[model samples]
Target: MDTMRDRFAPVVSQVLDEDPRVAVVLAEIGAADFQETARRHPDRVVNVGIREQLLVGAGAGLALTGMRPVLHTFASFLVERPFEQVKLDLGHQGLGAVLVSAAASFDWPAGGFTHMAPGDVALLDTLDGWTVHVPGHPDEAETLLRHAIAAGDDRVYVRLSLQANRAGHPVDGKRPLTVREGRSGVVVAVGPMLDAVLAATEGLDVSVLYTTTVRPFDTAALRRATASAGTDVVLVEPYLAGTSTAVVNDALADLPHRVLGLGVGRGELRRYGTLEEHVAAHGLDAGSLRERISAFLARRDAVPAAS
Candidate 1:
């Protein structure tokens, strides 16, 4: 709560105060802290109370009436539960709003499988022109939210996960930020997984690129980074495994290179346990990731370089 989730309310509050066009639609999940915000602007802030469909529909309605709606809820309820609402009300209408989703992936494991939305970004891909930002820290979340509000009419999705990096990478909103330098390969850490990726690559000869914006792929930046670093790419995503593999493939289409994809598995694990246990079960723990990546790099090393 001290990290990503807690950072949202204050940003939304500031935006609501600063812009009359901004409206917040809640659905019982994030209604508590924002109750006063809703009360202050009775007509602008609304809590639809567990009705995710109504929640999205309300945001759409607000958008149609010339207001920019900022929708907030758990990832599952925001994207999966009311997917139709998102597809129709938001996408079909060609409306623009800021979608901030909490409890991303396996945040609250106790809430169980039903509470997770590991495929949210993949689903967003089905729609056209949506920019997805998976901020890895509270500071980045606040910065991204502020940017989204300031940018006006961007179909933006800010993914807030319980797992976080120690510090914000400070997105440029254009390209992936290269935080580390190397020569053999490039490891692209998407959002919250940066810390894990950093720890995993402790002694490896690989560059690390941190990005919050996933959509639009930032192919140019990726190509530049990868090409400069021997073109070996490893995408470490926090969501469903291989979600961004195709993009990476397309980005490096012209080159002969090796790539490794890692993230949460597609098949259901069907076991309830602590966060660390869940992470380990998915092979996302730092130690497991290090071993997997080490093996991948070793395979590339085994190949004979061009004579």
Candidate 2:
């Protein structure tokens, strides 16, 4: 099966061929993949070499000229290094651009710490009006990419990753899809973390809510799930742990609830290991998630109900 990043070039290429107003800006990361596309649309596809800031600036410039720009690079450089350009050129200017990032979190551990970007989503969260999509499968990635492109002058970020689930879930880019129903609690799995979350919550009486769209978070769906199941939630993300905990808290502020945010921890793992090893070390594996989720739910269940 092709990874989300693997599916990005073809989808963008097709969009470029179909839409005249669409432009792609690259920072020398995945330029090779778009060599043919660049040749086809010399004016639309642009490569700004190793300059990450220039890549974002050029995309913003394109957006300013009434063209929808899609920017691509590794997450570390795309969002982290060029964050000022993103904040000023895009956000402050109120321009729309599809920022597509590859090598999510720890996809390229061998490339060392510089390539990892577990806080990309969290960083974007600090800014306002940014739509974020974290697709679990390549199909979902394609869907979200198309959705972002047609979003019409809205700031959008489509996070691509080498990690993916066994199958793609139906994503409408509006609300969360309920994967399983139960009365205990709700496990909200984001992006590539769905499979581990499902495996962890198996045989448990917890509802599973899957979503590729994180920004403009589905508060309604979450409220509905929590209303049926008790006010307990476990957010399992592929990025930094507790990244969405604040949003979850605000969403459930009216009701008394317990939320356990699970994902990549902030602690840096100096060792360059396999992806599976990193997952295990971060306690994001199925067994670890199960233990943590079960424990948190057990504690919540132990609490006496208000009379």
Candidate 3:
């Protein structure tokens, strides 16, 4: 299923075909790299040159004209070149458009840092009214894409990773479910890191909450999940420690919550390797998570119960 391009391609094509009023713009730098569906639906797909800023600005213009635009490009180019357009035209103007970012995170390893986007999450996460959804699987991708197409939200950003196989299930926009629940401690897991968190918490009392939607995170559910746990809830995200992560940590200020941020680390990831290797290096793998969880539990136990 790794190279199954035909699988999700048709789903995206079908959506573009169904919506006659909206425009689906796709901009790719190289040949043989464009989306199959966007190619199939040629009328809707907009092929701007290698310039990503113009691509996003054009999408914003389309959105201003009452046409819902879906901006498609690699996560690296989408956020890098079009920072002003995305932040001003779409975000500031409150255009109801969606940015479909591909190769999110280490999705493209052989392509090097220019291709890999292990930092896109932290970028869009900072934008106001920008909803970032990273579908862990193809089914989740299809469902989330459909929702974004129909949603009237101000702006939407969907990040697609190489580990899309683990996206699990398609959550309803109305009622998002709790993927995993624990008692003693709550681990707010996102992206493919859930695999690590889940494996580590085996036979443990910690609860794992996998968030598919970042902006509209189920705060109500989070509050309910951490209600009984009290001081054991830990807010974790794949982004390095920053405003977005800090805001999340601060959100649970009322309840004693510890934030364990997992990301590509503070400095540039100078080492070139596979995603697994990167995860191992960054201590986001199952083994590292287990050790961290064990240490956290030990520290908690060290503190005596109320007298």
Candidate 4:
């Protein structure tokens, strides 16, 4: 697996070895690499078979009883299936845990729609106080996982995807990192979308910024970048379309601006296929993104010059 999931197994194992407070509950996922880790620490790495509801509830109980519970499973099973458990069992209780999900968005298309969650972050947005981490690289994934484990009493969600950037970024758990500079506008690449976003915006005169943390939206950093880039921005997320647009809008309310939310097409409600197919169909492929973003910037330029 040329993805974050491959990198995460080791971190989980290390954490299990070192931290007594760190417990991992699984739902029939992570078996390949994590099985041995679970075997070594059976008390901590408990697998709940395919029962997702119990999977989440068990984590909540573990957290409630003073263990730093870390739950693992596919994005669809973790967030979409046992949503209420996540909503009430964890959110309402004001409890803290590390909810790590693999196979993000349409990563497991052969498994079909039964295994996709492009809107997971959007759903998490409705709930209060979740630090969502969507790392663009394996290094960032491990870094964010460590950050969450150290962050006492704070809930953290880490979404893992098959896509990755060319290199790892130096990202903190709280801010967006500016990767490139240009004068025309700013294109913010969220999580796994970085590599694709970078490719899509090549040769275009636009500032490029990246971030793994989605909520508690880093408007301060975004506002700064956009203000410098002429207050024009385009948000390219790796998940559902327009997921972060509202917060971005509120963030840049100090000035008149334009933003384009480029991501998985919400209107394309077809059965899941291969990752490439889903990505292309959503207009998230490099070519499609290039055209869309080019046009977006052109439209902004086409606006009559201010007197």
Candidate 5:
């Protein structure tokens, strides 16, 4: 099984390789992984060193010169390290640049908390005219990338990961990834964990809300998803709870709804383990989620149904 990066990089590399005017800009950290793609299309790769501000600025400059640029970097650095450049050079100027972020959230276990980016979803949501995507799986990532490349939008920041994903998951390029009937008590998954959520909810009356476009979200579709949901709505995200907290808060502000935001809480994530073990350690395994959901249902049943 290939990592999400491997799955998407090749497909995109193939497309960009065919386009003569397309170029790629990489942070020093990302160059090693995508070197082959850059090598194959030598005229395309631009290495911008440790300076992310310059990296984004240069990408904007290159895009203004008629070359389509895909800027690659760590999610943490992409947001915190270069906020000014991204805001001024990319968002404000409305320049065309596809920002490809790798190892989003806790995808980089070795990098620790400082590098773990949990605030991107909320941060990017505030940027006007910028397209934000958080692909749940590789195929979805590929589809989102293809659209972003062709979109010619001023700014597009993709929240990506190197996590492994099972193949053959259906990805809706036009709308949110809906796995079941848009019904009551939906499970909104942000990453490859949607598969686990599906397995856990087998035989249960719950909908799976798969979100690839985080910012500028399709509110209409989301509203329709919960139109039947009388209160049992939950959002299962891979990032920290705060990521979904803001989204759900804002989403429910005007409506009478109960939204549960689930995610990795304050804890020390195991450093020495396979991705599966880490997932288990974080309560992201299928079995743990199933247990939690069962308990939640039990509690709901114990409660006197409103009125």
Candidate 6:
């Protein structure tokens, strides 16, 4: 199975071939992947060469000239380093571009903390009108990429990760897809976290909703899922823990709900380890997740019924 980043070049290359209006700006992160495409569309494919700020600014400039620009880089440099330009040049000026990032959280553990971006989504949440897609499979990433390119000058972020599920699910870039139904609670799994979430919830009485697109926050699907399965929600994300808990609270504001946000912890794990080791350390492995999720849900049994 190809990782999402592995599939990005081919998808973007195909898009560049078909769409003249589409342009790609790179910060020398994945330039080799698009060598052939750059040869064909030299004018549109640009490499800013390690200048993260210029990469975003150039993309915004292209957007200003009525060209749909797709910017690429590692998540840390793409979003965290050039965040000022992203806010002023793109958000403040109301320019739109598709900011595609590689290395989800700790995908490249060997690269150290500088390469990881566990807070990318949380940082983007500060800006408004940005559509974020966290695809769990390459096929879903391809679908979301096409959707973002055709979205008509909207601020979109496509977060590509090395982790992926065994199979791809049909994602429409709007709402969450219900994976399984149960009567006790709802588990909202985002992007590549679906497989572990499924394994953790096996034989457990909880509804699982899978989503590649998380920005719009499918309130309706979440509401419907909780309407039947009770109001306990566990958000299993591949990023910082409690990143989406605020949105979950707002979505279920009128009702009584308990939310357990599970993902990468806030504390820095100074040790550099393999990806699986990192996952286990962060309590994101299936065994750890099962323990956490079960314990959180078990608390509900101790609560007295409303009189």
Model 1: which residue pairs collide? none
For model 1, residues 1-307, the per-residue Cα lDDT tens digits are 4788898888898788888999999998878888778778888889888899999999999989989999999999999989898899989999888888998888888898888888999998988979888888888888888888776787889999879888877676567899888998989999989999999998788999989889978988888787678787888888988888888887878888777888888888677787778788888888988998888777875542210
Alpha-carbon RMSD, candidate 2: 2.7
Clashing pairs in 5: none
C-alpha RMSD for every candidate: 3.0, 2.7, 3.9, 3.0, 3.7, 2.7
Model 3 misplacement above 4 A: 2-8, 29-42, 165-167, 174-176, 241-244, 301-307
lDDT, candidates in the order shown:
0.85, 0.92, 0.66, 0.86, 0.71, 0.92
Per-residue lDDT tens digits for candidate 4, residues 1-307, read: 3568887789988988998999988888876677788678888888889999999999999999899998999998999999999999999999999999988988878787788888899998889999999999988998999998888978899998888877898888888888899888989898878888889988998899898999778888887787667777788898988898888778877788887888877664566667888888888888988998888888875542210
Model 1 TM-score, all chains together: 0.95
Query: lDDT for model 6, on a 0 to 1 scale?
Result: 0.92
Worst 10 residues of 2 by lDDT: 298-307
Task: Tell me the spans in candidate 1 whose CA falls farther than 4 Å from its real position.
Answer: 301-307
Q: Assess every candidate by TM-score.
A: 0.95, 0.97, 0.87, 0.94, 0.84, 0.97
lDDT of 2 at 58: 99
Q: Backbone collision count in every prediction?
A: 0, 0, 4, 0, 0, 0
Q: Which pairs, if any, clash in model 3?
A: 136-164, 136-167, 137-167, 182-207
What residue runs in model 2 are displaced by over 4 Å at the alpha carbon?
A: 301-307
In model 4, the runs with Cα more than 4 Å from the true position are: 268-272, 301-307
Q: What is residue 223's positional error in candidate 4, in angstroms?
A: 1.3
> Native-vs-model 3 lDDT?
0.66
lDDT of 1: 0.85
Per-residue lDDT, model 6, residue 184, is: 95
- Per-residue lDDT over 1-307 for candidate 3, one digit per residue giving the tens place of the 0 to 100 score: 5522223345556766787756766665422443565566666777786878888888988887788887777888988668888888888888778887776666566778787666676777667777777665666667777788788745887766666434376566434356666567677666556666778778887667776677777677767777765555544455453324465555676765555455566665766778778777767777887786667666764541110
lDDT score, candidate 2, position 23:
94
